[model samples]
Target: MVLVFLMVNAYRELTPIVISGRTIPLKTIRKAVFIFCFALTLILISIFLILFNQGNESSFLKVLFEVTSAFGTVGLTTGIAPHLSTFAGLVIILIMFIGRVGPLTMMVSFGFRKTRAIPQYPEEDIAVG
Candidate 1:
């Protein structure tokens, strides 16, 4: 998704473009990239939280699987789900919630933003390809 945003921005910035047909807006790509990054960060944080708490109780791969399952909501585990600490369980729950509703959308629904009305300038035609 990040690559998509980069490529679209680059394409839009090219010289002597022609608008042959409808094209996706860069804003959508930017939002997708943002969501992808936020989900990646949340996954990493959740995995580390479980790993640090689990210690040598399980293999790293097992911890990773558990974390993935939690975020994926697949309801599968390597027999370690029963032994998760309270903190670890909470972390998994957080991951599940974000996974279900997405990080950015969740933040918006949670009132983490204030919409602003930006006045639009008069439309003008521009060449694109």
Candidate 2:
């Protein structure tokens, strides 16, 4: 749910907004991208940590649900949280804290400031696998 909302909000932010025959420039698109990526990374890490700590005790889907719920601060659980390892429980608690404080807020609080001047260099075509 929260992940869906983050993706939707990011899409909306990336899209240009028009009002009264004028298109509003989106300067925060990078910020939106950063937030989305950070959230995704957190979710993935949480899932990995829980799965590693729990071993085969819980299914992937259940771990995913628990992590997402914690990240969303929705307080929804599948009754697996209590049985999770201490480290896994801590991970969920951290996720909940980050979710409540918000990714952007966490980034800003951690000294991620936006620069006023954006440096642009010449585009180069590179090969990729």
- The best candidate in terms of lDDT: 2
Scored by CA lDDT, what does every candidate get? Answer: 0.75, 0.83
Off by over 4 Å in 2: 1-24, 112-119, 123-129
Between which residue pairs do clashes occur in model 2? Answer: none
True lDDT of residue 40, candidate 1: 78
Error of 2 at 122 (Å): 3.9
Against the true structure, candidate 2 has what lDDT? 0.83
TM-score of 1: 0.68
Assess every candidate by TM-score. 0.68, 0.73
Model 2 per-residue lDDT tens digits across residues 1-116: 33444466557764444545565445554666678889999999989988988999999999999999999999899999889989999999999999999999998888866769
| Candidate 1 residue-wise lDDT, 67-111, digit = tens | 878777888889887788888888888888777776787867876
